[model samples]
Target: MGNIDKRNRLDEAPFRYAVTKTNTVFIDYEGKQIKVLKGKEAEKFLKRVNAADSEKELQLIMAKITGNFKRGNER
Candidate 1:
């Protein structure tokens, strides 16, 4: 496996961080990578982290964002 893969697997739990490339940014939760966020969306994500809420909330937010993305793409 690649180094990043090995590192992720070696840890007892997943890591969280914002991934940035080009003009996009997203939060990585567990092994899932989201890539449909910017500006206010990013601010909201950071606020979630700062609020010290559960991972479930983050997952829900990710799901919501993903859902919106899928819907938008379908149009």
Candidate 2:
């Protein structure tokens, strides 16, 4: 996780999330939608977000939820 922070500099918090009326979660990175969480997953994600202590922490959570976003090999 420290590596992730060092690589991405989540201090700027590039990740964002939105919840729908039906309790679905949409996670976005750099203004692009990347992942969706529904049912138990949505509930769990919301819990973690609500408990986040800071913007950087929230960004980390979102990044983890999005899985492996980039592997540094893109041309």
Residues 8-55, candidate 1: write the lDDT tens digits: 332333334564654355655455774556778767766765674655
Question: What is the C-alpha RMSD, rounded to one decimal, of candidate 2?
Answer: 2.2
Per-residue alpha-carbon lDDT of model 2 for 1-75, expressed as tens digits?
566655665776778999999999999888889899999999999999999998888988887889784565311
lDDT (C-alpha, whole model) for all candidates: 0.50, 0.83
Off by over 4 Å in 2: 1-4, 70-75
lDDT value for model 1: 0.50
Clashing pairs in 2: none
Please report, as a residue range, the 10-residue window in candidate 2 with the lowest summed lDDT: 66-75
Where does model 1 exceed 4 Å of error?
A: 1-24, 27-34, 68-75
TM-score of 2: 0.84
Error of 2 at 30 (Å): 0.5
Consecutive 10-residue window with the lowest summed lDDT within model 1: 1-10
lDDT of 2 at 45: 94
